[model samples]
Target: MIYKYFKECKKLIVLITLLGMLIGMLFFITKDTPPTLVLKKKKINIEYGQTYYANFKGLVDTTGMSKKEICYLKKNVSITDNLQNEDQKSYPAVGKYKIFIKYNNKLSTIQIICKDTLAPVLAFPKNVDVIKESDLESIDFKSLIIATDLSPLKEIQIDTSQIDIHRIGEYQVKVFVEDIYKNRREKEFKVNVTENKQETTNSQNNQENNVNKIESENNKPNEDITISQSNEKNNVKDHLDNGHQQTKPPQMVYWYECYLCGLYVDSNVSLEDAKKKFDQTKCTDAIEFSGIEWRHSRFHYGINHS
Candidate 1:
């Protein structure tokens, strides 16, 4: 009886060991193959202020299996679950970030590439200087010289102190410039100061000649010209009768022109102020019209008409 009992106990122990092994194997088979994650779009490039989302789909042979715990493979990436799909996950961000999925302690690795999306900004131009026709006469230049910066791209303003004002001509210049992206830009313009070369040259020469003439006039002797007494008295009476009377002494026909103005110093224009209507250029023709008769002749301008 003792020998038979020992033999039966050894058979029962062997059967229990085999059953334990089978149960362990079954547990491992279910746990080893986790659900697979399928990513729809893995790479994204976006701007700083933009919004986006990462989409995905997943599946498994969990025909009779149930998910124990769902977790994220990555901690930083934001994940949103959509109950509509069998396996659902989404990640979105304006900047670059990574994401992953986990089911039942098994995780799917994350491989994502995100790009930056921001544009550089340009600053308002300053230090403006006007470019006139005279500048073009010396060379070629445009309407203005303006200073610009992209200090908004602070690194690009490497030579901030070097910005300067320059003039080349009326219609062209090399502008010192910087763009929003720190790019250097130069612009040119075309503006005509004068249409005719002859007129420009003549006007320039006339200005120079006038300066020389003034200098020479200063060196010349002051004339001791004296009018005959009879001429003076008659001229004085003629102006007085024509209403040249004033708080001060009556005007004299020094060069046959109104003293206050360069108009004809005659009797008929007594009604006009005569003081304001005269140009100094016409004053130089004083000697020819010194006589009342010639001064009274209707004035005709231009060498062609003369």
Candidate 2:
């Protein structure tokens, strides 16, 4: 019986040794292996104020990755940048940046460029009246233009080829501006070369003299009193015989002023019709008329009657 027990113990030892070897082989075969990471793009450009995501699928290639490995990488990937904030989706300012991405002990780098694509905004009057013979070269074109941009301006150019300072006419002036990021914008306005100062003053004085002469004539008293009194008596007798007095027709006049050219116009049409006529008769694209005023006068001093 003792000999039989010894043989059984030896068999038990051999079985236990085989079982341990099988367990060790299974553990070695099932161990996890590191994945190979490949960067698809090394440089990325994002517009100003654009949102950035932490997704690496577009920037990285993971062809043979299983669903579980992908999920693991998504949860464990890290991104670091100089301008990036933990709670922000984009950079705070416009400039060049470097982004570092790390996943599963593999490190990669990429360039993130924040670019400004919006053009500058320019604000100025649509019409500018410059006197004839004025020194156009002495004018500061930059000071007259109000430009707003997200970045510093590279250059501001004024195209005055269409303008003739020596002549009295309307001309177009264009302004072209560009930012540091190569964003460009252009705007145009009218430059009216008005009459010389001396000529304008002489014309105004002559107009004033004519107006004074008309006023004097209206205020003058009748010269032949006896004839005037006889005609007045006859007119009263005729009116009494007719049993009714004749009434003069009502006259309606509308007055409008051109804000751009500083010219006044008198019209016999309604106010709305007068405005429409004035707009239709505008010679320049920048000429704008003010609101019309109703008047009963047949003659205006500085107004062009129509």
Candidate 3:
């Protein structure tokens, strides 16, 4: 009975040993099979300051692996950028980087390209109103242009071929610019050209008529003041029934013109005083004119019978 019990125990021990050997052989054969890591793409591009999600879909079968092994493989994967100054989290510069992943003593490299994503903003000034054929000699586009960008501007191009200063109408002016990252922007504006000569002449004539009307009301036959619209000097003769010759003091007429203002003034007062009076009476708005013209004429007063 003791021999029978020992035989049974021996058979049980042999069976257990055979099972352990078979398991060991199976594990060794499976280990010889290489691990697989498949990716959707070998390279990827992302804009600067963009977020990346680690949704790696192609992880090999972790079925028979322990949780510790899977965690170790995932943790070994890292992404690094080639930019010099910025941190790894925020890729501030444009360059190429590598995404390296290590699993099962294998290294997989993926290309990651960083690029600029922001577009440039362009702004234009208020509409430009200029005289026809007068101030067209210079066009300062820099003053009217307002541009901003995250990167340096590559170029600014202006197209003014449609603007014809000689024509009395509104035209379009187009502008375009680009940034370092190939981002583009464009703007269009209007340039108005109108006839100002007719307006100025009519305004001058009206002012002259007003001055003449005022002088006519104040002047009398014996002591009259006459103003002529002639380019040359005129002599005023004073006649007396007594035939006695008496010379009257010379009368001074001063002319004032401001290019910005269409009003003209002629008076016998000093230049400073004349300007002050003109500013008070006509230039109530006190708007500044760009240019000025002044002239003075000396003549004697004439008596008119009419």
Candidate 4:
């Protein structure tokens, strides 16, 4: 009986020892710690041409390791900070980049985004002149605009709705442009529409008519020179030799000037009929005035010019 009791006691002692070892293993695991690093900022932003430095102010856990242990861990860790490439150092292009930080078998990330906030430089013309009937395609719009932007230019828009190319007047042309980042710029310029050749000719004719009217009043003949129709026919041949004859015989037509445009209109029909004919055809700009002067050419019937 004593022998059997001693065997049972031995088994009980072995069970207590195994239980104590299991508890000790659990305590050792609980006391173990992990290396850690905490960062104050994980993301940063900067301008395209601004300077950047790779720096981190954070807490690093060295709970159960010495400086040598940490140094060894750092050697195994890989750090890649490609914020500034070779090209970026010279000319920084706007973009986003990531910094990879790996230490103590742990991974952390940093984000950097570059932006362009400055306004673009502009070189624009102050004024431009174009004829009223000028063609739009003939204008070199691109050459007139000189602009530079940090961000790429997306598009340029021109607004010419207020300018009438068919009318003689001053108008405004607005130019607008935008960058890739939605940065916008605008400029305005004056556009002058000048008269065409036909209009210039009309102005010159008006001046001549004014001069002729003043001369006719100043030089009144002392007596009217009478010549018979048969005698006039005989002198017609003589007038032709003196370059005082009409190359094409004059037709019996009403000759007058448009009061609105001051352009002379001559027709074989009556004054009213001439106005209607000009209205039906685009003989000149749409007439705004109806007053007409009944006049005849001074060169008619071989009247020599002084």
Candidate 5:
């Protein structure tokens, strides 16, 4: 009986010791200690050139083992954190990057992908001209513009209703090609508009001057003699043989400045009753007028000039 009692006591003592060891192991691992680290990102979906936040959700530490290193392999980044807090993520390139968050010996890793699959496009030329009076009623002018972005460009509108320019201006517009990824590239200056007619106010002024000049010439030279068609041929031939070019030839007088055509040099005779002084001669060979300018020339007929 005594021996059996002793054996039972020994077994009981051994069992107690084993249970104590198991309990002690538990205390060593779970007691007064930071658990493990759990790092989380605020969003899984993000765009290129976009921002995302990372947060440390759970962590436990007793011996300052909570200090962790964060790293991204693709972007050559390294960061250190002391608590379960926020994290920053950036997609600077086009590819997948592995993200790592490690607490001393414990670690968690994820993949981040950056992508670009879009092309940039031209936007607009809205109002070509600002106001009507600023430009000639017959002249063409400049336009205003706008630009925008949609997944792809659907339409671009240009207002040309006011343009009277015969020539069209060339303008470039951007067009985009897009994919599921929001990444973008640019193809600049792809559309154009050009004005068809070259406009010049100076030219129109010359025409007006020519008309006024012709009328004034009719009034001033009324005192001069008109050559009879019958005698004019011989007289002209005779004059030419004498090496005398007609003084009143349209070439010699700027038509745009003409104000004395049929008038005699005496300046006293009336044009309706005028008689010839240079009947066998020619009119003034050269003209000098005040503040005068010439416009243009045209082909001459045997008797009249255009």
Candidate 6:
């Protein structure tokens, strides 16, 4: 009976030893195997003004990983890029950048291409007026526009192909602008070209005629009827001494006179009438009249009241 019991114990011990060896081999075979890192994509595209996250979740999957391995990856994963504000999640500028993700001594790379899809902004008037036969070279088109963009401007072109300075008609003008990123913007406005009438010539001529008439009156001789004039003056003095008060005529009051339009008006003229005359004339909107001053020599020309 003792011999039989020893034999069974020896067989049981051998079976247990073989089972332990198999388990050891399995552990050794799988010990150095790395955890799989499944990535959704290896490349990402973001706009110029978009934000990028440092700890972007769902980009890598941690499924089938042990609790310890997942914790290690979460703690050890790091992302590096050329962004200035990497901690703030905003892209610095528009360019292509390579992002390095490292976890557990393994590195993964992703390409980020920052692109600009927005166009430039333009602000300009809808209607413009140009004088006929104007000097086109003196006109500064840039001063009349306001352009804005995130990138530097590449070009600003004014298309005045339809405009004719010598012609009296309306034309369409276009302004085209572009940025460094190939973003473009276009704006259009109407330019009116009108007849260039010599409006100030008539006023100047009228003033010259009035001056000549005044000079002639001042230089006129008093030899025609001197005795009759003296008698009339004596009679007027006698009438004044007799306590007869002679009423004086009201003084003429001139308000404004536009040299450009030959519009001469007194205080009796309404403001609306002056505006109508201004509109009817070929004078520019900048022309206006101010307080008048009298001179014995020449007329005071009106100035620009814009």
**Candidate 4 local Cα displacement, residue 138, angstroms:** 2.2
Whole-model lDDT for model 4 versus the true structure? 0.54
The C-alpha lDDT values of all candidates are: 0.33, 0.58, 0.53, 0.54, 0.33, 0.56
Over the stretch 230-265, how does candidate 4's per-residue lDDT look in tens digits? 232211111233332213332335443544345555
lDDT (Cα, tens digit) per residue for candidate 5, span 1-306: 999999999999999999999999999887545444434442143334332233332111124343232221212222332222113321244455555566545555555554444343333222121111223322221121222222334333333343333434433333333334443433323121222111233355457668776444433212112122233221221122333222232211111111223322221222111112222223243222222222111111111121
lDDT of 2: 0.58
Per-prediction TM-score, please? 0.26, 0.47, 0.48, 0.41, 0.29, 0.49
* Superior candidate under lDDT, 2 versus 5: 2
Could you tell me the lDDT of residue 161 within candidate 2? 88
Clashing pairs in 6: none
Best by TM-score: 6
Q: Residue by residue across 1-306, what tens digits does model 3's lDDT show?
A: 999999999999999999999999999997665444555567777665333332333323466656765565456544333434244332235787766666556677777777776665555543554456644545565455656554679768888888788887877889888888888887887766644444566576668768886545553333212212231111111223443122243344444454333556656653334444444443332322213222111111111111
Better of 2 and 3 by TM-score: 3
By lDDT, the best candidate is: 2
Give, for candidate 5, the lowest lDDT window spanning 10 residues: 295-304
| Model 1: per-residue Cα lDDT over 1-306, one tens digit each | 999999999999999999999999999996775444444444434432222333322222223324441232122223442212111212233233555545445554444443322333222212222222232232212222223221233333222122222432233323444544445544433222222233445576668768887444444332212212223221111112333221222232212243323355322232122222322234433334113221211131111100
- Runs in model 6 with CA error above 4 Å? 1-35, 61-73, 85-91, 195-306
lDDT by residue (tens digit), candidate 6, 1-306? 999999999999999999999999999888766566666678878766444543435366776778886766666677676555333332347877877888777889888788877777666545555556666666565565666554679768998889888887878889999988888888887776643223344455557768886544454232311112223221111112333222222232223355433455443333333333433434332322122122111112111110
CA RMSD of all predictions: 34.2, 23.7, 26.9, 31.2, 33.6, 26.8
Q: For model 2, state the Cα shift of residue 49 in Å.
A: 5.0
